[model samples]
Target: MATDPYADPKLEGVSIRSLPKVSLHDHLDGALRPQTIIELADEIGLDVPSTDAEELADWFEDQSDSGSLVEYLKTFDLTTAVMQSADGLRRVAKEFVEDLAADGVIYGEVRWAPEQHLGGGLSLEEAVEAVQEGIEEGEDAVDRSGRDIRVGQLITAMRHADRSLEIARLAVAFRGRGAVGFDIAGAEDGFPPSRHRAAFDYLASEFFPVTVHAGEAAGLDSIRSAILDGRALRLGHGVRIAEDLEVVQQQGDSVLVTFGDLARWVRDREIPLELSPSSNLQTGAIAAWGKNLEDHPFDLLYQLGFAVTVNVDNRTMSRTSLTRELALLAETFDYRLEDLEAFQLNAAAGAFLSVEEREELIELIGEGFDA
Candidate 1:
């Protein structure tokens, strides 16, 4: 077994990084480049911790690993500060997709709250358009490089705010233009999805796909509201749903577990768990289980038949990639290539893409694994 967590391990003589992957819970503002942040900050007359790219990267890693949500969120304050301008948002979005493409991601959904970008005086529509322009540029760049990538926007609303209804409308309006889904983020503890009922009701009427950030900063009640009120097609993190499970007995490799109603509903319905292993550990989302990856309950979730998908929620903050996430899981659980492929299949099935497009993704994943 490899002692290095970041090193890629061969799964049947094929590197996991080379496998086609789908990212369902990655954040846009959370994946900024260090050099880009320094330059953008300079242009806007804002101060940054380090002007040198490498040092700035180290600064981010240190702050995020500080074990404080407040400290971790301060990094985004710097990133979003630079993203207040149209050019900045466009450049960041473009580079975001390009980086993912280089990292071997074939399909990804970049989620960010547009309401956070309007401090620069751009309307939500203009902000959305700027991001769309950048996404198209990145897609074109990937195509020119003989690689193909497709990324969609998951327009997000801040759960602590009251603009979800408007944000939902914006997301649905741009459905075909780049936006594929709706989500609510920020301060998941006090603000449950019930606060955004109007928005959820409107989205349900419009048939827009929704995902809510639950089970990270809160518990089962929050997740219940996310489903009942937000009509979430997917649960962001959703790790706490495991709390509802009662492990009755353990017999070596086999155990008898009883599930609560919510747990049963989510599992039986195959609602995807957008689990970001490293991020969950950093945010203390899985702290109840244990501190290390081995204690994550991720293996249990997988074995229990949850549609669990691996992700890097924030690459910059987590100092991780999809490859690193998979590598860590494999090292912890001794998973094989088939286990990794199962996660990809779950993500492909849960993607907001049409049935035909999703089938194409499934076929592509199967082919990649076969090769």
Candidate 2:
């Protein structure tokens, strides 16, 4: 029972780190420990910015705070570079689960593009197999430690790439193995989900679950395509869906707002928004609102009854964990423990799991919060 390094001071006499959480948008490549990157790079002859993990961690944070989605994405080059082998992918994935468990995550969905990891002469199937092996190993390790955690894969396809159809097939092929859903990530501005319609169509035909990276780097149009074309069950960092809302008036905690068709539909439909406050600030997703965490539309979305689930889109890059994210939001929005519980319950309801499994997660979250 090692103490969680990311634990925040108790809020309402409850340690945020000890609460059950469901991570819906965590990325495998983006969640690697800085020290692991150093050792992995050493093995593969890859050069990193700094051998010192602390310095490398700072470097990631500095680089990610560039306030441009494209600029923020450049940091992934180093992370993805080290994940180009079976062993590297396996190790990273294993540690990813272990770290989540340490942070009190009851369940998580680790997203990564298999196509990006093929540089080590491993095929798509091999890369997935390696990651699955790592996830299982991590889960077993967690069980042995007197804790329980389950993780699933969200096999991602790079939006700018032409092999989404191939990647989609790979995701569906891994169903019941490790993969639980599909997503199209990277460069969401120009490479709309419509561009990957063929893949989405195929996934839809198979009744496979889908989530798309939209409304973060882009706006309403991107979100529209994600739902209409990509058929996303959830929006990855869909914070910008706020752009569709026009604040007509405001007074203290009360405000009058007008929602456009897109925003209205998304909210009314209860399509979960995987809103990562830190990552949104770092990547300029909420630049239109303001430059600080309080400026995020997360509170607004939640108040408006949208299924707002907090997440750490990239743990290492943002230097964040779910606990830290929750602490920040609670501090900023003056949220109570029940608000935190609501977010976790939203995430559980939106998980890419069967109704029974989702209910179980919901029950676990409720019990943990009650304790």
Candidate 3:
């Protein structure tokens, strides 16, 4: 629906990139800068698809667009390969925060599986501290540049692996230090959140927040498991939850729809749906709805009062930023600045922060949009 999906636009006389935002579903390994990836890969003697930074970036985008989950996952193999050391983790996490700040994120929770990064002989706790150090450094840099930004870690466990409970303990151990939440990010179909019930129960016992990657690679059953078994407070790219809704009819500005129990609960509970527009298209998460931006159920969910929040699930792979995602949604749905602000508010509310902190972020968003 955008004149050019790649072009940036002004929303109600405001630059979308300059508006304050909250990123809740961002991935650490999935968001490397192309040049950084090339450099890091070279440092580890790993051969990449392209030596040129831009070429490598294009390669990632190309691979992700293949509509094959196996092909799409191969991109992460390259990213994770170079991130096996403390230095690599620190640098990547630092840049992840810096990039989010540059994209107007006031607060973000970056998620990555610590077990995947332990190949460098770093313990789970060490890897988390490394990322936390980088996050602090990035926060300081943003503050020096006259913009305040903050980021927290969401320690992730590979869904198909056996270390989820260990990762949960690691996440809870570093709560105030950096880690704010726990998640499982690998395969989501056969490996449902139900498999990690032990980890979820542990996190719940410690009162730690959990957000699961469901409704992306799977369907409604996966979403149900995320809530019931994982007790997920927020869903990572929970777009397919749209499948649980049945549209009755549209009467100019108001549409009547029927909600399945799952849909109704998710809506009534105001559980945030971390909807990544471009990534959803690339990963076929919205294939059931349609293939184009115009056909995305984002607007439908929003109109029906589902707590829909925009995100860039993989900035490099999808070649998108939160700003770009918001711009695309505005173009497709003809949304105004107020709508954009509402989405940000939803994200702030769903963030793994204290009520006071979320209120602070909500106030910051209001001030930014009013500028």
Q: What are the RMSD figures for all models against the true structure?
A: 2.1, 1.9, 2.1
Please give, for residues 241-271, the per-residue lDDT of candidate 3 as tens digits: 8889888998997888999999999999999
What are the lDDT figures for the candidates, one per model?
Answer: 0.91, 0.94, 0.90
Among these predicted structures, which one has the highest lDDT?
2
Clashes of 1: 0
lDDT of 1 by residue, 70-121 (tens): 5667779888999998999999999999988877789999999999999989
Encode model 2's per-residue lDDT on 1-371: one tens digit a residue: 33545466579888899999999999999999999999999998889999999889999999999999999999999999999999999999999999999988999999999999999899999999999999999999999999999999999999999999999999999999999999989998888999999999999999999999999999989999999999999999999899999999999989999999999999999999999999999988998989999999999999999999999999999999999999999999999999999999999999999999999999999999988
lDDT of 3 at 18: 88
RMSD of 3: 2.1
Pairs that collide in candidate 1 are none
Error of 1 at 316 (Å): 0.5
**Candidate 2 clashing pairs?**
none
Candidate 2, backbone clash total = 0
Q: Which is the winner by lDDT between candidate 2 and candidate 3?
A: 2
| lDDT assessment of candidate 2 | 0.94
TM-score list, all predictions: 0.97, 0.98, 0.97
Mark the 10 consecutive residues where model 3 has the least summed lDDT: 1-10
